[model samples]
Target: MNTIWLGFSQKLLKVDRYIKKSFTYQAIEKTFAIILPFIIIGSLSMALSSSVFSKQGFFNQIYDISSWLPYEDVIKKVLEIINTVTMNFIAIMTAFLSAKYITRSFKKDEQIAGFTGAIGMLILNYNLASFTSDSNQETFLMQDLGIRGIFISLILGVFVGYIFKWFSPRNKQEKVDQYTFISRGVGGLLPLAIVLGILIGLTLLASMINQMGVNGLFYSLFRLTEIKSKHLIITILFLAFFNSILSGVGISGPLGIMQGGLDDTSIVSNLSYSLKHGTSFGVPFPISIHTIYDSFGSFGGTGMTMSLIIAILVASKNKNSRKIAKFSIIPSLVNINFPLMFGLPIILNPILMIPFIISPLVSMIIGYFFIYFKWMPPAVYNLPRTTPAPLMAFLGTNGHWSALFVSGIVLVVTVLIYIPFVKLNNQAALIDGGDLNEK
Candidate 1:
């Protein structure tokens, strides 16, 4: 083993320094840290979508408009509070992730604490901000405050580094000068102030405009006297249906097109949600890809109708395999449905086609009834499905808690739809190689 290790090390060291430095380690790091693991999000998405579409699904059971405050408002309120808190939470996490990466290199706990504080400021204490609009340059970066998060983290790291260095004797020098023009005297902090001023000024202007412009203008549009009271429910229903289907379409098509279109859930949900909000076309929203893609945005096609496909994949196996399949079922319930689907490649399989095709549509139909009859409200935005699909769907749609029951219903329906197909597919596979080619 030592000879092999030494031999490989010598061979690796023999490579050109420039080529090795640029690609080798960095390339391998990105593959495991970013790419390969990315596929798992796709699987998670499948679990998420299936959960949403199940008749016993979360969307159906969530809080409805009828449950407003004092009665069921408790339910709705919890969802609202979550949505409000998490709107830009992903972006804030991103900044911390960046800070964490930088700090982790030195094995310092202060790195996490420092970035967490800075992330809090950008998220709760500030507004959406930016520096550059051009996407082509390496100079571009963004976070919770949009581009402002990127700039602030750099500046804050410098400022924090200064305070930290002054207090902690081990590290006396900082890299603030990289961001600012000067590093000493009042002039040194001047650049930091300028950046802060711009952010503050832009935020003030935006706030003022909302108060004096769009928000005010829109408030009047929603006024009972200004718009028809009769059309309210109808408008809500249309929007609800459109939003639900639109979400499914995005997750199924563009997002998971790589997974046989509708086979993947994360891709479908995000793409559907994105296109609905016009994010794919450059418009950004609180729940847009700018906030979701890297983390929870890739689970749609992997989950939707795929959960049943997964169960089918597992159910078709031997008793030992069935045990494993049964075990995966519970985890899939909370949006971890990949153990069976990929475990058996039910992606484009002809037998498991039963659930793949029916689950989502059935869920959509059931979900539609809840919205149609005013049992639930539309999902207003995208929330991290990691927080349990029912709960997340409830909050994601802005206190439309009825979405939870609707989602639960969808879940039941998905399982039912898969039952027959799973049995048939299992029998066929058993006759074949018992692994797919035995026959």
Candidate 2:
């Protein structure tokens, strides 16, 4: 068994290396790495603002104590606004980061490229009619400004980055005073002008396409808002697999697509059924990716790395691994695992890849069965996506202890599954001369 496992690990490492060398993959990885702090901040704001623990969150819970606590309302409002601005604008921010990394890869001015990409993103979603003489033809929708826009934003980022790279003065060694900021600013003129021109042209082309009764590229790409039931489980499994694989390469797949395009038809349908029946006692929610998978399958963020964090804390003797676990604990509680994911540098590590991909799938199945068997009530409340696990189950199921209990069980299972994998990783690190103790 050891020999067989060794052979598989060698092959997996080779594939991992090949993937790391891909320019596209590297761009995506670096984009996520750059934007990770935003994701964490946004998630933290959402979690704090959510009334998961109460009927009306922090404000309502503290309503009666208003006289004692000054500025409760002010604090609450600040958190909500923070959530709106940061979490709500993730798509546009991602566009900026993607372009920044892609342009940097081409050895061009990344800041200029990033600014251009941000402008392009805003223009693509901007309502021309609202700003122009056609006031009666307002076409901008609020949904398009958020998660739905991520896919197109990423594509546009790459497009704008490439255009900037193409127009940048290449292979020219001009002697200029390094101390002069104006010299650098002037150097960006050609690429900036060209990128802006193309952006304007694309906007006109999109408008023309809209006039022909076609939804245009922006609408077509962002309109995948539904994931119907025919192959729902299969879709969940595939998403779980793909998201893990992408995260293994340091790309956030859920932030890119799954979280954006996933439909909640099952959750909605089940809630409607429960309402009409007047009792949710025996009826269970259908196998729902949003309710079960989102709440439990991704217990510790993208690759469900929380379990791995636990394993590292409990079983690993390596001080570096323990330190990672220490730093990751608080973030893990909030369902943010990027620190561990990137710091442990799970990206492209062959040994950790296997269980990283499999753990979520296993957890999804476990959660589905628990709900299907009526071991817990269906998750009716649309809890915040950033709501931490087990508690997410509790709030989502409307104060069901059973749901929380089931979530606890799934978390334990996840931890157990990750133990051996963590052990293997630790052993390999030790063999490779990894520092086992703190200096």
Candidate 3:
């Protein structure tokens, strides 16, 4: 088993190196690094707005902060705006930064390319029929301009960058003059036209489909899949796996999409049953994405990454890894792992990918069995997304101690699963002559 593991780790390291050296990966890494501050701010804003200031928030319910705190309503409104701008507009920011980095990678006009990419993203989601309306206001598909549209944003960004690289004239002279600026702007015109033309065409098609009453085709497909699945367990596991993979590649997954202010039918049913029975025990749809994956598998955010942070703190000797883990603890506790995701650089990490995907699946399986055997009640309450992992199941089950205990157990198991992989990452760093402490 040891020999087999060592061989697998070596092959994984090779793949990691190849991926890390790729232009796309490098561009993405840089993009994430640049936008990380915004992500952190957005995360904190969401946590505060949803979990601290809101009337239904865990802390607000306990403390009744609005009654005592001065200008509480104003503060909540401010935070909400901050959260919306930073989080809801993340895809546009990502497109701008990704295009800039990718263009830089090719020694092209990054500024113009970046702006072009942002314009393209906006055009892709723009409602063309808004032009025919009485109101002068232009409408955009706000949903696709946020986290839900990041994958599309990334694609458009990269495509725009490449088009600029291929079509725009390369900067050959070292000296900068007014003529240089003119030449750069002229050079980018072709790429900009091509990108916007393509984007407009796609938008027109989408608008036509919407006119035909085929709205939300992307969301409808997933909803249909959920409605049609015969085996609940298999469906849950498949979503967990699929979500993990998409998240690993830095795209928002189905889980994220489904959970965006839209309650799952199973979750709604379970919640209704629990409310009527005054207990989560024997609730309808006991084993569900909410009860299992969200409750157990999402500890420390996507991939049970909170466990990865703990594992790194316990087993890794790298100073950078440990420092990042320490910095990430607060955010991870509230189910925000963006710090660790980009800081530990888990987005494209190969070694961590193993546990990053596996840990969640294992946790979900444990959660399923725990609910199946009546060891704990199923989750029923709709808690804030920023709620702490251990408390999620407990609160969701209406203060079930057994649910909390089971969540704790799942957390420990996920940490154990990540320990060896963390050690392997340290070893790989050493082999590459990289200073783990400095990295």
Candidate 4:
């Protein structure tokens, strides 16, 4: 048994090393981790103003100064603007960050990389000709600039980085004082011009394809927002499982790539139909896997690792585990678990992989059944993905306390599920001569 375990550990470490070395994983992982603070702030802002909490939560009662203010509406608008600036431009920011990371990896110019990312995103999402022709300022849809565009932005960022790197002067023998600003400008100009021309050509091609009665590739990718039927439910379960597996191997899961296009419209439509017919919404909610996996299954980002943090804090016998728990507690509270996910180094660890992937699946199943049986109302409101679990359930269900209660129950259950795994992980660390006093 010990030999078997040893061999398994060795293989796990190998896979983990490969994943860490992959450039795509490193770029996406760093980009997501960097943007998490913004996600947390934006989520909190939305939660405070959401119908579920705007006039009812303890925050409203304690901070009722808005009621006394004559300019309460103005204050509300300012809050909305804050949320808009932070969360509404998430894709643009992610593009910049991803390109920046890739540029640094290639030892190229990071500032230009960020600029290219932002510029590419703009070209991909908007047509400059149409914008210049339109006199109306409200022509652009904000959703296209936010989470809806993340996948496109990510692709564009990486492409820009690679294109720039290729265009960078390579031969040291032909070096014309490349360190000078003049030499750098001369080298970079062609790449910038070439990329811009390619963007225009691609846009024209997409337009031509749309006019030719073909479903344009860009539109198909951007418009896949609703999932229906039992088949899609099974497909999403597999997608979630696959993403978790990737995450466990130290690769950033492709949630935004594989499932980002899906939205909460199906659940909203079901709720609307139920209201119109004066009947309770049922079974369909069981298949609303988009919101379920996001709000419940991803209790603490990718492998439901937040519960593991809780377990480490409350039940661990190892000092290193508790130290990691303390450091990760704040970020986990806001639904950012990168520190715990990588630091406790759940990424490469075999002992935790089973529960890491399965726990979220189990949570999804439970949340679905709970909603299906009317134990909790179906989530209708489209809350931010960064919304923490219990509040996520509440806001999503539009003030359904039962949903909040179920979220709490799920948290406890997740922690309980993580206990044995945490214990085993601690034992493995001890046996492998790993540090127990890590800060």
For this target, which candidate reaches the highest lDDT against the unseen true structure?
3
- Report the lDDT tens digits of candidate 4 across residue range 308-418: 888888889898668767766555554556556545667555667878888888888778778667777666665544356657777766677887887888888888988
Superpose all Cα atoms of candidate 3 onto the true structure and report the RMSD in Å to 1 decimal.
Answer: 3.7
In model 1, the runs with Cα more than 4 Å from the true position are 1-253, 256-317, 320-338, 397-401, 435-439
Task: Output the TM-score of candidate 4.
Answer: 0.62
Query: How do the residues 118-165 of candidate 2 rate in per-residue lDDT, one tens digit apiece?
Result: 877776766655656655765553455554455566777788778867
The TM-score leader among the candidates is 3
Instruction: List the pairs of residues colliding in candidate 2.
Output: 51-57
1 or 4, greater by lDDT = 4
TM-score of 1: 0.33
Q: Determine which window of 10 residues in candidate 4 has minimal summed lDDT.
A: 210-219
> lDDT of all predictions, in order shown?
0.39, 0.66, 0.78, 0.66
Error of 4 at 100 (Å): 3.3
Q: Rank the candidates by TM-score, best first.
A: 3, 2, 4, 1
For residues 287-392, write the lDDT of model 1, one tens digit per residue: 2221222112222333353345454454554563464465455445464543443343343344454355555545555654565465554444444344454444
| Candidate 2: segments with Cα more than 4 A from true spot | 21-34, 51-55, 58-69, 80-105, 109-114, 132-161, 174-189, 206-281, 284-286, 300-305, 308-312, 315-357, 371-387, 392-405, 418-439
RMSD of each: 18.3, 6.3, 3.7, 7.3
Query: 3 or 4, which is superior by lDDT?
Result: 3
Tens digit of per-residue lDDT, candidate 3, span 336-378: 7777776667877888889999999998898888888998888
> Number of clashes in model 4?
0
